[model samples]
Target chain A: MLGVTLSRWTMSYFAAALAALLAGEVLMTAGYGFPSAPLRAPETLVVVHVVAIGWLSLLMCGALFQFVPVLIARPLHSNTLPLPALVLLLAGLGALLAGFLQLAGTLDPAPPLLPVAAMLLAGGFALALYDLARTLWPAQPLPLPARFVAVALFFLATTVTLGMLFSFALTTGLGSRPLLAVAGAGLPLHVVAGLGGWLTLAAIGVSYRLLAMFMLAPELEGTRSRAVFWTGTAGLALTVLGGVAALSLDAALAPALIGGSVLGVVALVLYGADIVHLYRARKRRIIELNSQMAVFAFAALAAAAALAVTLIVLGRLSEQVGALVFLIAFGWLTGLGLAKLYKIVAFLTWLECYGPALGRVATPRVQDLVVEARARTWFLLYYLAVASATVALLMAHVLAFRLAAGAMTLATLAIAAELIRARRLVDVSAEIRLPAGAQRPHLLMSVPHPSP
Target chain B: MTQDYLDLDVRPILRDGGEPFEKIMEAVAALAPDQGLRLYATFKPIPLFQVLGRQGFGYAAREIGGGDWEVLFSRADIPAETAPAATPASATPSAAGASDWPAPVQEMDNRELEPPEPMVRILAAIEEMRPGEVLSALLCREPMFLLPELEKRGHAWRGGFEPDGETYKITVRVGETGDKA
Candidate 1:
């Protein structure tokens, strides 16, 4: 009953984004950063954008395109926005990554391309936000999903604006301000908005409908989901605003800044609790590969949050290590998203083709799409690679970190392959179709009918 | 005669509807037989069952699958002493009019102005009506699929079921001027 239609294009954008990152990984492996690279290396920016814009952003946008309508029980205001959004974002992201790569080695004329690309990416995102907003306009008194979407929009705006500002500031050498004077000044804000607001909030909203609908669990009721929403939202807002102010040396507001973080922690905890509750009530005994593997991302967030809080309290939050947290959140959430998309695409394909023939003719079961057990192995390895990378970066083991990054790249490539297979890209329907003389049995029939 | 019963598969008989069920019911009555001929279908049209049962075709149903059911109907007056033939043993058969059978419960309840108690009363009213049967106070919410389901079942409601504040009520008048019935 939903009218979102951007999955195919979004997956393509996702694929392109991963390809760019894998290319960057190759560059880094070839002694590109051999001479004690700065913590905020340009190559790092390339990897960051690949994970952020390429994987997580693409996954989030595609999923929202497919899912938001179902959450609101309404269709998108217009179906045409996704195509342009996909094209503009992918092109802009490609340009921006190339600019970052060029800057990493030696400043080139391509530096000017950064702002241009950022503007295009921002414009694309703005259009998406507009389309989504208009569609959600008549949603009648706003549900919890709408609330989450609203917050995610705000974060999207902030992240894009901050990203653009950073892009411009990189060229102008606005090194007077302490935070701006630092190499990776706006990293924390970008991380907070992109990870906590955009990815986390959107994922939560999407999960509410998806998990319940597929598992046949009852609709979420009471104030718990709402509480999680408000807490996460308010916490992130405080954390972002406070961190920004503190960076600007607003020492008076530092306590409020800390308070905001504490609230964010509370929100994450509440969100974690809600997820557990959702799983408990689920009717589907077996959670498919996506959700089972996705829990690590959630765990990583909670764990990273605790570590961040400790570092903040101790007054020793390192910029480089904070970057690592960004990696974990982006990698894990995006990885889970890409993994889940494999199943969703397969399922939607089945529904589109076979659903009408349900009682009229025999159809394959949903399980026939892919072997879940094998997919589960890839997911486990992906998470393991992420954990190792996070630990290696924290300990400042440069060689181990690069090795772990390669493993991560390989794992992600495997995930992409699995998604391609799940979509049945190589499989023909004719191969699986029943022969002409075969008797097709009803799925709901208790007795299996013998072939006539 | 018993061999005749063994040779007949009851599937086509009940699938043939009223006349066939009646003929089978008649044969059961003449049998002084062991068991009744049971008619089973996924949909249990209550009127058909009531007609056959009242006319001496005994039937019982047990749900076998989520929405599938098995119905068993046997002769009502089979001898207490005789172990009825595993197959039909009737030598002679009579005809059962079975025409006085009440219409389907849905048809009987069409006369109500307000929601009727026991609800099935609404069906009774509809069945009794010559042309217009009023079915009132049947709750229908989010009726897109439901209205179509009713239509597919040959039920027509003018302006369909509407809610009375929190609860819904409707009058479904079968055999209206345009109705096929």
Candidate 2:
């Protein structure tokens, strides 16, 4: 298999998706769609969906497509799905953004376009889920991490279905007054399903494998890891379903929400402990910048939970809702993604370039592909900006928020530069002179680096 | 199958001069049409297995002791696709396949080992393998990373999950093409 590895296409799509995320952030920083903008405003919705669906989802999907093959030790059921999925997702995303723009009263040419957008987006998710399930179908007793992914996909389907129904309500001015009222009340459920059930659950599953692999620790197959899995699954299920009952049926499911949130927190706390333990038991004593910085992502998750729980306990849900979302998205999920991205890109690039001649030729280690100290500074600045932004949003300080956004934009640009360099194998192959008449195509074109 | 084959031990050359690929290849070029070769090594000879197999030879290995293995090689006058029971599993590793592969000169359970450890250990073991040795290893997953290394070094290998599906067992034979499927 000449330079063929799982999810190469998916990773390429991830690169493109990251660009879209950065663009959305830039637009938000420029005050195009932001905190000061009307709540649920179309432009703001555009930015949010772009980051949520376009960037983060694509990144996660690409990572999964690659890692699953490694986990199962077989090729994916179909390697060609990612390219088509990417196309569908982007097309759907563009349509959804246009629909949002139309809702903002900017483009009202079509009578009801949001439903079509929703259908396209649903189509994309359906394809991704089908491909993912098929890839995992043959495993007799699926691994813990794979099981988590499977459950998360179920939540994603539920979330998308509700989202599509809500889009129809918003666009077509649907029939029943009671249905509209329930849909309006149920909007937050969609948010929870997407962020909590889909994104957070999927991340936990992948992290279990990645942390153990990268840290050189024994696989955490103990009772505690199982605890994290069950608690998380049960918690997300109750929270979403309970929230639905309260919204649609106007029933008193407060206990369910409270109980579910508590379970969710328990899951996170256990997961955090597992992470720390894994780090302690690691055979590789020297930790790299990416894994080291990943600590902050974990901390941010705990902090976000604390704040959310406090808000719920105090009945101050409306006070700083926007800020809480910001911290989770930027400080936790995006932060973790960025940290992992640099490492993954370097690993894949190394495989692509140096893999063929690995035994025959002297090869550079994966760490040699990029300058860590250079990336370290950017990571620091990025986290600082996130922290500052988090504080400002918490305090309702407008000027501070804008300043932090500017800093984040700068830090993001720096990191993007480094990421691109890693992808291109910047300093790896340019200086190496191939022997005359050597026909080794990939190695000569440039190559992979080394790591665990 | 020949009852008696020429015995050639290259462990001494490997320990002294590193890889004895050229010396072994020279001996292969001198073999008769119906002749078979028995080689001894410190560890499974991974690279040599594929190298010799490419020349139309079937091989099996059996481990005699730690850091010691004996592999039997026979020319395939009929272009046999499958490797015959190499030495009748001098000692089989406890697994489902119930294969009669050569006894592993070195046995490693890499289930607890992480990525790159499995790769590194396998590479290091094979480097010390004399002609006709075999190495067996169990891992958490297939060492996809090691496959390219095996190809680069001219080795033959086969691996699959244990009946439990959690444990992946692999075998490497030097100077003989091992089973691919």
Candidate 3:
């Protein structure tokens, strides 16, 4: 049956993300065994990669799989490839996280597997890109949000390639004094690709449409919206290129790094302000849990960027700076991502099951899927955990850090459980069913809740 | 006689937006003595279409394709002739001017004894059907933009083509009862 197949890309991405989460847990647990040294450790790098590449990357891809069609005003390009793509990404993530965990240990079997796993992940992404690109390719002068997503795909591709390059370098055991040190140069490139190009840009584009729809505000178009896209795009490109050059060419690229960072910081500030403006202008007075939690994450991101800029100017990218960067990347960016996922999963399930019956018959509102009050509390607890971890990491308190990690794990698990409940996968089917005791309300579709 | 209504150009003056709209409205306002101007404008949202109806501009709006509407407007404040004329064309005053209408709406002006086939195609599908049936076809990818012509002819309905997250089946109905299911 040509039904709405579960998106292969989404499945794969989620699988990888779950594997990464498990790896993070394992690394934290292992910390208890190896308590001598924790800073700049291999295990730490493994945990970071698991969260960055494995977790967040998948989450973004899965979301795009669902949301892109809605944005473009079309059905998904293809439903056929989701399962294969999901399997490939899941297997790749499994191998990749395993390799990282092995590398973290004293004796390593991770080296050989890294390149293979990278290739598999890259292949999975490539297939997904092709499918998504089909949706965008035919449109003349693609819409604002879609354009951002299209361009972000390129950055995603670049990020994957750079990730592979780093894996190759590690596998080959390049000396500390190599002419072109891929690992050293590629780390910042990965950060740029993920944080600026993929997450920030994609998030802005999505927020423009979603926020407006949610808030019942005017469309986020016209000159200022365009400026946000171009400025953010240019800034991220410049910063990534400049940082890469600085590493490869020493003082020769110092000017580029300085200029790029400034541009990047400026763009980020504008984006932050824009998000705040959107929230402020919202017609809905009471903010939902996803949006409310996202505001703190957004603030943390902007603050971290500002702090990083200051530290870089004063030449203080020491362990403390690294810890802060970790918090922003994982705690802020990933936390916001998780919060948003809770809403998205529920919303999509509603569309799949209840969207068709809106005109013909009565259906339950999206609110019926989950309890909002509980969601708000979970979000608050998640942020609390993030804040405590950040402080513990700063103070170099190992015991406190572990406890905070446990708290984060609990919060994330709770949110994931809530997502499953919202989806009601066990209950959803092709049959056009109505909620119990429902009458055909007037043809007006109730508005889905917006971000704060 | 068909040639007379075939050339009737409609220009609506938008409240104050652009030439096409405003000119169209002005053209509609300046109807020939004893002749009504039929203005066709698509309304994708039924609520907005109904709002226009409440504002004294009567029309017959039908969902022809996608979420698009084909609403028909007349210069007079009265609703567009909802029921097709049962009498011979020679007897109806508007039928005498049917020849002056645009080609598509006037294609059947020669045979006034029967309802305009295109108008019949548009209105026959929607009249007395459920609101959901009307809206299902309205929101399709290839929305019924021609529905405006129907509204311009003076039909009324409740509600809009809401994105209620519902899926409706839209297809060509082959019978007079307007039953698609």
Model 3 spans with C-alpha error above 4 angstroms: A1-19, A22-26, A29-40, A105-111, A173-179, A245-254, A425-452, B1-181
TM values, all candidates: 0.68, 0.78, 0.67
Q: Evaluate all candidate structures by whole-model CA lDDT and list the values in order.
A: 0.57, 0.73, 0.56
Write the residue-wise lDDT of candidate 1 on A171-273 in tens digits.
Answer: 7555556556322455767777887788778877777756655543545645888888888888888777666666667344456456767777887787778
> Is model 3 an incorrect, acceptable, medium or high docking prediction?
incorrect
Q: How many angstroms is residue A18 displaced in model 2 relative to the true structure, after the best TM-score fit?
A: 0.9
What TM-score is obtained by chain A of candidate 1?
Answer: 0.84
The candidate maximizing lDDT is 2
Best-performing candidate as measured by DockQ: 2
Clashes of 2: 19
CAPRI-style docking class of model 2 based on DockQ: incorrect
The 10 consecutive residues of candidate 2 chain B with the worst lDDT sum are B78-87
TM-score of 1: 0.68
Sort by lDDT, best first.
2, 1, 3
Candidate 3: tens digits of C-alpha lDDT, residues A1-452: 11122243453355456556656645664563213256456666666666766677767777777667656655457755555666677777777767766676645673478888888988888877887788667664778888889878888887787777777777865555532554665576676777768776777677776665555344566676777778777776776655565666543545655676677677677777677788887755665677777787887787678767767867775546655665676666676787677666655555445443332344544556667788777778878877777777667777877787777777777776676666554333323334432222211122221111
Put down candidate 2 lDDT per residue, A169-270, tens digits, no spaces: 887866876567557777777877888888888888887778777876767778998999999989888888777766667676577678888999999899
